[model samples]
Structures are given as structure tokens and as C-alpha cells.
Target: MLIPQYLFDAEAFLAFRIIEEKFHVISKSRISLLKLQLLHERALHRGHLKVAQQACDELGALASPVTGVDADLKTEVSLRHARTLLAANQFSQKSGNAALGLPYALASILFCQSFNLDLLKASATLTLAELWLSHGPSEAERALALLHGVFPMILGHGGLELCARAHITEAKCHLSDPSYSVHHKPDLVLSPLKEACEQLELLEYHELAAEAFYLMAMVYDKLGNLEEREKAAASFKEHTLALRNPQESVDDILNMI
Candidate 1:
């Protein structure tokens, strides 16, 4: 069973506040690592990573701990550390640091999945796919292999379409260069994404479905099908409008979008 939301939110918030306050004051490597590890856990729960690198820097300062922690706890700590490394690697790649994010990204995937946290597992896989397509195509093949394994997990959690579509969008960004043959048949990937969005719509996951439709528009735009693009855009508009004012009519939503 899922943990109670209120308790989870309360604990996460307290952890976040404590870590933010301690980040500057704690100088000991071991202490910093412990605090940052907790901070990373909270941030993951909230799906925000604005301070992920700073948290990772703290994690990197410590010597690896001796192997006394429970195996599950050890896995959790390792995965959190790997996520920090992945964040650092991505930042470095973006800021013209040497392209070395793939190893850390791959490690993050391996470790995060050790605990069966589906969101983190899917995220790591998706990030690896993106890193492969952008900074390393040979690595991208390895990432695809990893993705094949993780894809079923993502599907079980109803994230397969969203994850696939996001990867396709990232691939397009890198593949736009004629020299790169990164484009896939959108129908194959995008169909699942669309299905996922429809499912979300049925479940009243309006905000998520809105995001999905926005992504679909990106795919349609890339395919140069203006009609499909328009349709996706309309869906995005409708969903987002509904989210903003659930009582609004479809016509009103369309007008707002």
C-alpha cells in the first residue's frame, strides 16, 4: 500500500527545510553527504531538481561508506548519490564541461532501479536515452538496451507513452542535423504516447494530459503535419483551460488556449 500522502508530504517538507538550512553550515564531508542524501530524497518526491547539483557536490565530498547499512538502504543511498552525479554530468554537458554524463547517467539507472522506484527508474532510463542521443550515439545504443528493460516497468506504471514520447522529442532535437539519423517512425512511438494521454484524460488527470498533448504537438510539428499539429494544440489548449477553470466550456477553453 502507498504511504499516507499527508505523512509523506509532512516528512518531505521537514526534510527539505532542514537540508536547506544545513547545506551551508555543515562542512564535514560525512555530515554533508548524509544531509544532501536526505535532501535528494525529498526533492525526488517533489519532482524538482533546481538544487540537485549542490546537493550532489555534498554527496561527492564523502568517502564511500562502509558496507554495514541494510542492503535496501544501501541501494537507496547509492541511487541518490548516482542521481547527484547524473545532475552534475548534465550540468557539465550543458555548460561546456567535458562530455562525461553518460557513465553517471547509466549508473543512476542501475542503482535507482535496485529499489523498484518506478518513477526514478523511468526517469533514469529516459535521461540515459537523451544523453545517448545527444552526447553519445554508441552509448545511445546501450541506453536503448537499458530502455528495453525499463520500458515494461514504465508501462506498468502508465508512463510508457509519456517516457517514449519525451525521448522521441529529445531525439528529434539532436537528430535535426541531417548527418544524424535519429528520427524514428513517430506512429510507432507517438501512438503509445497518445494512448497514454487519452488514458490520463479518462482518469481526470487533466494537468498531466495537458502536458502530454503539448508533447504530442511537438511530435506533430516535427512531422510537418499542420493538421495533426493543430489537433494536438487544440487538445493541449482544452486540457490546460480545463485545469485552470474546470467549469469552463470547451469553447471557452479553446478561446483561452
Candidate 2:
């Protein structure tokens, strides 16, 4: 039940939070207050680190005093902090960053789940799996391991555009995976892709909806389902033209058929 309009408010709030995170807080007498300041600073430092171990430490810093945060800020920072961890995880996944991405990504996943932010949680879980997968075929085996954890979240959230996008993001992971299977693999992606398409249609996300059908068509092609592929291709064209002009006539889209 995440309303799209709330995003406008969220954007504004995220901006304000950035300012709050950046505005220097003078160290004070209270030990509890000092810990909170340390937590905030370390959370922000997540983006500054290139190594994974350092990022992990940064995550620890945030986690240690997370309880000290006011309830309201807890909700606000939970999502934002998760996003920052993912960012740092991506940046540090290679080189000296070591397993830094693992902790950051894991923390992000936990924070999202703790708050019942299903769409965000799903995205975070998929991202964590992807980080493990990037190590190659052996690691990719774990990519879908935690996907089930997020599925219920997605179902509960229903049909928001963000929910759809989250599903599409994870589905793409399976689609692009090198080790999914020698065959019968693209079939694995169809359900999530279809779910994404349905959600996008509900939200009137014309451009993205078109892309979803195009992705579905590609999956059908991979599965060697000629009839379904053709039908999907037809829908892809329809959605594409819908973006060009929402009221475009079927005859115009049919001309290429």
C-alpha cells in the first residue's frame, strides 16, 4: 500500500535527512549522545571506504548504537542506511574491499526486513545474492537462495510500481546469470517478470511496462515457445507504442505485424 505520491514527500524528506546527517554535531558530555554521533558519522563514512572490511566496520558502528536513535529517526534512517550500505557494498565488492560488501549488503537486508519494508527488502536481498554471485558460477549458486525470503514481502505489498520494479530487478538477476542452467533456466525468470509486468500495468508505467513485455518476450524466446514469444512480441510493440502516444491506435501498432 505504498502510494506513489508519498515518493514526492520521501524525496523531500531524504533531502532533509542528508542535511541532518551532514550538519556537524558537536561532541557532548553524555556518553549516549556521543555514541549516536559516532554512529551517524560512521554511517556516512560508508560511502567513503573502498575496502570491504572497512565498510563492515562502518556497518558495525551503525548497528551498535542503532537502538539509541529516536523511534522516528529509526524508521527514516533504516531505509536510508540500508541504501547507503548497498552503495558501499557495490563500490567495495572488488579489490581490497574483500568481504566488505557482504556485511554491508547483509545489514541492508536486515534493516529492511526489520522495518517490514518489503519492496526495499526484496531489492536488498536480491542485491546480496548478486554480490555472492559475482564471484562466479560457484557463488552464483547462492543468488536465488534467499529470494524466497522476499517473495512474501512482495505479495503483501501488492501492486505498487516500486514493488513491480523490485521484482523486475531480482528477475533480471536470474535472467543475466551465467550459471542458472544449460536449459529450462529462462523459465525461472518468467514468473517474476510477469509479476512485474502486471504491477507496471496497474501503475500505468507505460515505458517500463513496454520493457517488461519485451523482457517476457525474450524469456519466451529463450524457452523456444514460438507462439507465446510471438504474442509477447506483439504486446511489447503495443506497450512501446503506448509510450509514444498513450492513445495510439491498434492499427498503427499492427502495421509492423
Candidate 3:
């Protein structure tokens, strides 16, 4: 939502400090694990690998005994661990270790993200996507398809405006398949989809706008308009590349559909 970069950075830095202080006091507690996970996430974002690794080590130690922990805390730890792997470029193999917690982590991250936990949400979603991709093209495609439904809920649940927009963009990229159409009726009206898109756009979510446009293209394609479909495809390609480097764009993501 056109959030100031400085504001985000400042908030992240503050959170990291608080988390670090909290960890020193309760390093052996489950709550410390939670703080470590978050601190590690912030460290990763700031490209502080040493700190991130230290946080990850603490999180890993706590991962096993998280059963009796609060559901949300457990979810946060799992998500943070997965995210650390993603940041390290080890997402391909390591994400599988956190597979079981992927969905829950994604949900929790979405909630936290909605509330301005930028670093946490970004790390979690990026990892969740990577974990899904590690399962192979079929699973990746499935994850992308489900994103349309899953993301809207996250947005409704109080996800951050920018992160939610990024997610919608990712979802649109995944759903770019001309042949992948769903016919089942959703339990809720599809109005939230439009509403979320609008909110993102109002918030200067350019990346998200690009994604919403791409998703609209998919809908147009499903309606059998060749001209409109081509326009949507082209727009998707344009915006996707603009938001990130072309190499990072999911250029062939539509192939899965």
C-alpha cells in the first residue's frame, strides 16, 4: 500500500532487536524459539546470515518439542525454519523437512503479514511456495491453483497490504493456464477477490496490480476470448518481469496449467 521503505526497515530493525533481547533471556524456552525464528527472519532480510543462522539453530532445536506449544507459536517456528532454508537457497531439498507445517505456517504468516509483520510474512510465503515446488511440477501447479482461494482468505484475515498484493500476483502467475479452469461453486461469493485486488491497488501495490491483471487475463481466457486472453498473457509477462528480475519471474508457470 505504498508503504515507505524506511518505515518497513525501521520496524524490522526494531523487531529484530526486541527479538534478540528476548532470546537472550529465554533462550531455552519455546517462546525464545519463536523470537529466534522471527529474529532469524529479520536477519535474513537484512542479509545478515550469521545472525540468521544462529536464530535458525535455536529454532531447529525447538522444532521437535513444539507439540505442546501454542498452535500459533508452533506454526510460526515451522514457517520461520522453512523460510530460513529458502533464504539460504536450500529451499529445494530442505523445504521438505518442514512440509507438514507449510500450510499452517502459510496461514499464520499471512495473518502476521496482514498486521505489518513484513519480514515474517514474506519469508514464510516464499518458503511455502518453494516447498510446494520441491514436490515437483504437479504439486507446484496444485499449490498455485489453490493460491487463488487461499490468498483471498489470508487477505481477509488481516494480512499486510503489500505482502498480500505480492501473493495475489504470485497466484495470478500460477493460474495463468488457459486450460486450467475450475467449475465448482465456492462457499463464499467471489466478491472478496475483487475487493482485495482493489485494496491492494489503492495501496500502490504495483506488483499486485500486475498480478491482478494477469489473473483477470485467466478469467478472460476461460470465457473464450482469444484476443482478451492474449492481452492478459502479455500483461502478466510485462508486470511479472517488472516487479522482479526477468530471471526470477515464473515465466513458464503457465505450463503447469
Candidate 4:
């Protein structure tokens, strides 16, 4: 059955931003399912395991109550919560078995990319796709295709940064495959990486440019193209100081994914 992407997008969007304010109480009869994704991420980064676990527990509660006055809301919160759990590294599943949250996350992410079309959703989807790819080769091939297909979908709507990021993601996914090895060919992933760098340059997103350039250098190195590798490395260093605040950055956003 063809599910409604609009409804999914709105549901996921609300789940992602459920906590607009601490004082706001009651939301049309449903619980105020808060979004504390950032809190858990930040807590872990700061070595606050307790805080991170608390966030996880909060996610579980938010994800609970599959049947209630707000059924759709429950499903949406559960999906976001599952995505959060998958991202937190606090859960594990057997080999060759997809985690419970992953399939739901992937479905909503695709729905967002195919129909919802928003910058935040695009970024989130790409991040989840990367995670899916990291599971190994089979997932990598699927993710490579998905990233390529979604790139155009996001191009016009995801803003300059997100579009560039999508290209970079496509490039990285390509690099994950054996066909991308320089021994076989020097161009498998270079095109998109270069495109991403160029887009970043146009947008004056220098920090992101640095990362793209660095990855380009690695690809060139693998190709044994010392001159091109040197050039890319130089460019990467040139953009280093131009980066945004290290604490809050374009690169860091990619990491958050």
C-alpha cells in the first residue's frame, strides 16, 4: 500500500521538534512527547553517561504507548525514538539481523526524501543512510543507489549546505565499495566529492570544503596521483582556518548524523 508521505513528514517533524518549550503543557490531549536527541548526543560528547542514559530512558517512554488517544503521534514518536536509539550506540542486534528501529527509520527517511522534501529531513535521512551503509557491503550498495536517487530530490529544496552534504555522502558511499578502489579506477567517487567541494566553495562553507578536499586527497592518494593528492591536501589546509566555530560547525552537524 502507498502510505501518505505528507502525514509521515508532519508526524516525524513534530516528533523531531516536540519540545518547543518546557512550560507549554498539553498538546491537544496527547502527551508532550519531547525531542531530546541533542541532549543525549551532547551528554555523551561531554562524558556524561548518566545524562545520556536518562535521555535514552526518556526516549523509551516517548516511544511507549503505541495505542492511545494519539495513535499517529505514538507511531511518529516511536520512529524518532527508535532512530535515536540506533544512533546512540547503546543497543545491539544479532549479526545479519536488522535492528528493530532501523527499518522504521529507513522507511520514514525515504518517505521524507521522496515526498516530504525538507532540509532537516534530508539531512536526517542522509545520516541514517550512512549508518545503514556502514553495516557492510549489501547495505552499502543499496545506500549508494538511494543516495544517488535522493540527491536530485534534495537538490532544489535542501538548501546549499544540505545539497552539498548529500553529494559528499554519495561520494563516501561509493568509496565504500570495491569498484571504487583506485586499482580498478581512479574516478569512481571523485566526481561527486569534487562536486561537493565546488558547491561548498560557492556557498562559502569553508569548513565543509576542508572535509571534502581532505576526502578528495585520500581518493587521489589511493589512485597514486601524488600531484592531485598534494593539491587537494593543500586546499584542505587552506580552508582550515576559514572554518566556522569548532564547537558549532557544518562539519560537526555531519558528525551529529
Q: Name the lDDT of candidate 2.
A: 0.54
- The best-first sequence of candidates by TM-score reads 4, 1, 2, 3
What's the TM-score of every candidate structure? 0.48, 0.47, 0.43, 0.51
Superposed model 3: Cα runs more than 4 Å off: 1-38, 47-50, 60-67, 90-130, 134-137, 165-257
lDDT of 2 by residue, 1-257 (tens): 54432243334445545555585473222333333333333323222322322333333444346564543334334434444454454444444232444665566566655676666666666556656654555554466566556667666764465566556656766765675651565656788788888777665556557767888888777778889989889988876675566342333222211
* Best candidate, lDDT: 4
- Error (Å) of candidate 1 at residue 186 is 3.2
lDDT for every model? 0.53, 0.54, 0.51, 0.58
Instruction: List candidate 4 stretches off by more than 4 Å.
Output: 1-104, 110-124, 201-210, 237-257
lDDT per residue (tens digit) for residues 1-257 in model 4: 33332233335445544543443554622332333455544443333445555655665565435434443433344445444454344333334323555765655555454554354455556656756775776677787766766566578677655677677767777777766665675565787788788777765556557878999999888878899999999989877764423334333322322
The lDDT ranking, best first, is 4, 2, 1, 3
Candidate 1 local lDDT, residue 213: 79
lDDT of 2 at 205: 58
Q: Which stretches of candidate 1 lie over 4 Å from their true place?
A: 1-50, 54-64, 68-71, 81-100, 105-127, 136-140, 157-184, 195-215, 231-257
RMSD of each: 10.5, 12.4, 10.4, 9.8
Expressed as tens digits, the lDDT of each residue in 1-257 for candidate 1 is 34433254346556655765678665545444555665554443223345444455555545455653343444444444445444444433354222355565556566666656666667656655555555544455555565566666566664433454354434333334344431466664466557766665654545546756776787788788799889989989987776666443333222211
